[model samples]
Target chain A: MLEVFGRRPYLVLLVMALLLAPVPFLQLNDYIVHVLTLFLIFAVFATGWNITLGLLGLKTLGHHAFFAIGAYASALVSHYFGVSPWITMWLGALIAAVAGIIIGFPILRIRSMPHVAIVTLAFAEIVRLVFANLKDITRGELGFWGIPPFNPIGIGDTAIRFGLGNAAGSFALAAVLFVGVHLILLLLLRGRCGLTFLAIRDAEAAAESLGVRLAAWKLFAFGISAAVVGLSGAVYAHYLMILTPTSVAGPEMLISLLAMIIVGGVGRFFGPIYGALLLTATSELLRDFGDYRMLLYGALIIVFVFIAPAGIAGLKPRLGRKPAEATKPVEAV
Target chain B: MSSTQFIELVLNGLITGSIYALVGSGIALVYGTTRVLNFAHGELMMLAGYGVLLFSVTLGWPVLLAALATILLVMLLGAIIQRVTIAPLMKREDWAFNVVAVTIGLSIFLQSAAQLIWGEQFQGVPYFFSGVAVIGDVRMPWQRIAILLVALAVMGLCALVLFRTRLGRIIRATAQDAEAALAVGIPSGLVHTAVFSISAALAGTGAILLSPLVTVSPWMGASYLLKGFAVVILGGLGSFGGAVAAGFLLGLIESFSVSFVSSEWSNVVAFVFLIAVIWVRPEGLFAGRGA
Candidate 1:
């Protein structure tokens, strides 16, 4: 199984996708489909997060700012102007990208690593506070409701609707988005820009000496990542038909995203997807444990950091190498 | 606002600012010596608040005794956490990321555990000192004045320890260069543990002081954690005196914003100021030795 997966990776991905495609039609309960749909959405969200965190080596606790921006933008446009969500989603992404650039430019220019994390966190808090206080627009803590769903795509008599109002439709939309993002990320990873990002992450000084524009590339990564996350947020708002500060820009969202990437495998192509699926599933299964879910997630992080800092995807390389070689310390960038 | 109102706001800001400095200095001290940002710093404070509640409110101990005992307990927990989670990952190349992840994990663990044990209800202990003091046109609560006085006293003690003593010298050496400190027979590991414990103790003290001002909840640490970082950053990372100065500055900023603008904008203004400060002077306002 490992050999086949290693030799023809696409085959494994295809099989996985094919298996998941029929999940909605399997006559499973609505709760199951709902969870799966959430899994898919977060899979996309986490994947987007990986672009900045794993590949670009940016420590951001503020991606939720972009998520909230996309959510509010989509919701507001649809509600105030009666625009279709399909169009407003892109607008949301664009606005988020701009906001990302605005924020990323200053902090990325001055701060590095851990400082970036705190600054971004502060930025996210600022965004949340602004949204919460802007009662006229965001309705304060009461939140905005009755958001219109994305218009369905279909021929005259055979319309195919999609959104949270219909569980299957939500699943379908999320699945398609997950695949699209996955493909885009895969393609990018195979390109020069992706390699440059990895080089920057591994050794910024060396990459800079090699003529790579560190600031530009970092900002680019930030913008693209924010855009993708914003798109997910836009969809999330429309699907849930409600937008709130807690739902969009809360620490819980940030923690869950961090958990997904850490557990799945940082910098690995399938890490976020795997992490999202496994962690989300674990959380769902542990629903019986009530509030212990967060505790479990926290414990999982601590355990992973100590026992397997490389995460599940990183296990393969450890297994493949000799013990002595594997144990040799690598210099931290 | 009138002159009395202005004086009142400034006084209140100083009280809050002193608390921020007290907490921020602890964080700055730990980072100075260990190079590890304890994201769980606020969680330690929250734990200390709960500790106070348990001792004084539930067990009916004296407030002073409960406060002292809780600080000591949290200090021990901080040292243990450093030993168990942070110490192992210290030698790794990816120390920054690993330390951060571990602390965040520790934070979540503590928060949930607190919730499980203490339940979700917000709890508050009775004020250790009550009544108002009037000075000229200004009226101030004695508890608020106590917060400022205690915070200043602790900070002064911290400064004295860091500047005047042998242990202070060793901690300073470790903060400057760990390898050099170790070569000179200073156990850097022990110093790290000491710093962690001291930091937690400071946060615990702040938590106890703050318990009467705000309801104690598992999630109370979240906001304080951010504000603490803002203070540390504005003061300068690993700079003791810088954190103190920045703490008061941030307090005034927040207090004035709350008074002049909407109360909601106070936090937003602090963060915005933090961002601006970082962008303009990332080294911080005071830029202490070795910063």
Candidate 2:
């Protein structure tokens, strides 16, 4: 597998990936870049959710709570204590990880897929409810604004010379994140835990018989996945400089995450990336279609799932058996 | 704020919860039989709401007629959905997937369709009973009282049918064990379609009965659907009795919370309880009732 994308090919793809990162730099205004930045934010969330739903064979409809937790954690730290958002982002991730781990232990022990999704969705909704109702603490629906922006090391010096503003700096920060996440994901895919995750997806009974700790790995994957999503949320809270309970744990965000994973192929390495890009971009591109946008997207997803569970990109393998093609990478847990 | 208001709150909560029970039972029945969570089930209720709004508000028909039209039309709509859309997808393990995906798609489709047909403005369905009634010193809306009574009656009929008749036996058999029901010569697939129809009909009843209290809007189903899903989870997914109890419980909680807490906090309270319950006991408050 590594030979096909040998050092030279991988280097080229990596350069291409780096080129993709500079999209906001070429953009004219902050609005476009901000939306593009949102795409990046959701990409991280979708990838995190993919770790559980796709890799672990656990269909979760909740994780919105984790996202909210991270945002709240960072927001609380920055808004109240005047801590740096970058530092608080890690704290937010930790909080969400702990919550995810706690939830995973009991819920993942149950033996049903749809039940898990239902229960998770309920949990997320409850988190949203609490956040909305806890006006004294979280500020409820009015939302929390005026969060201090992040400043990376050595970036201020570079920004002064380049004359880049907050928006541009935000884009740069997100770019680094995109690259970091991709690298980490690539490493995770090659690990033994990744293989165990895939085995669990294939057949839990068989995997259990093979000595994989059911609760342990499931909780591990859910925890790490949540931390990743939480980090994304923390960055988002600081970047947007506002945090609303609705945006954090709402229908639209949940649907976006689900749509990305579903359309991209649930268990593929690039599913979240490809899916987020397609859905986010297309949802914008076809804005003129108004409400039909979701309908069309849903239809497309249904057709894809029906004909190609591995997703449209996975269709490359069916034309001819060539070792050159990237095998449909099962997004291992 | 007062002792009178407290009693009023409890009564109001019970009334609102009655509507939830009707919707929840319908959803549970279909799920019990078909193992499909119909996302569009809420849409049917919305459509019924619009139906009554059209009949009572726009057409200026009698309230009874509007209510009847809603139930009939929505039942037909449910049957047609099953016959045309759902029945074709019933043969595979992917039956539930197609059901969920298509219903989600259809929900978006129906919401927009309503938007195009009725416009975005909120349309009120006139109260079945216009004035408030008093039992002792506590005043109540006659419509609220009527809604409670009708809701209970419909639920009672539903329970009777499920537990007392030959058709009920078939539904119970299918829900209990589809493979065994089929082996025993019961047509489980047909029963699934029928149960789905029955479920939609119940949602339609909720729409008609509750329409007077709540305004009809294109996106009304979204919020209500979340509540229905929550009640299902809280009560145990396929348990009819559980759904009824949970519906009341959620409603009562919302009512009392809204009285003591902020009105905005009521939904939050209900949802938080939902999450806590699921977090503590993933099976929900009941056992083996979920997918």
How far out, in Å, is residue A113 in model 2? 3.1
Question: What lDDT score is found at residue B14 in candidate 2?
Answer: 93
Q: What are the per-residue Cα lDDT tens digits for candidate 2 across A1-333?
A: 222122343354387467766675685577666667777778888888878877776877788889999988888887899887768989999999998997786576576655676667767877787888788888888998777777555744554111124666676677677778767866775568778888888789999998998888889998988999888888888777788888889866776677787777666656677788888888877778776665666566556555565553354455655455446442212
Best by DockQ: 1
lDDT of 2 at B113: 75
Error of 1 at A142 (Å): 1.6
lDDT of 2 by residue, B21-140 (tens): 888878777776777787788899998888888778888888778778878888889988777667776765545555565566667667777777778898776677888898777988
Writing each residue's lDDT as its tens digit, candidate 1 over B18-61 gives 98998899999998888898899989999898889889999999
DockQ for each model: 0.71, 0.37
- Highest TM-score, which number? 1
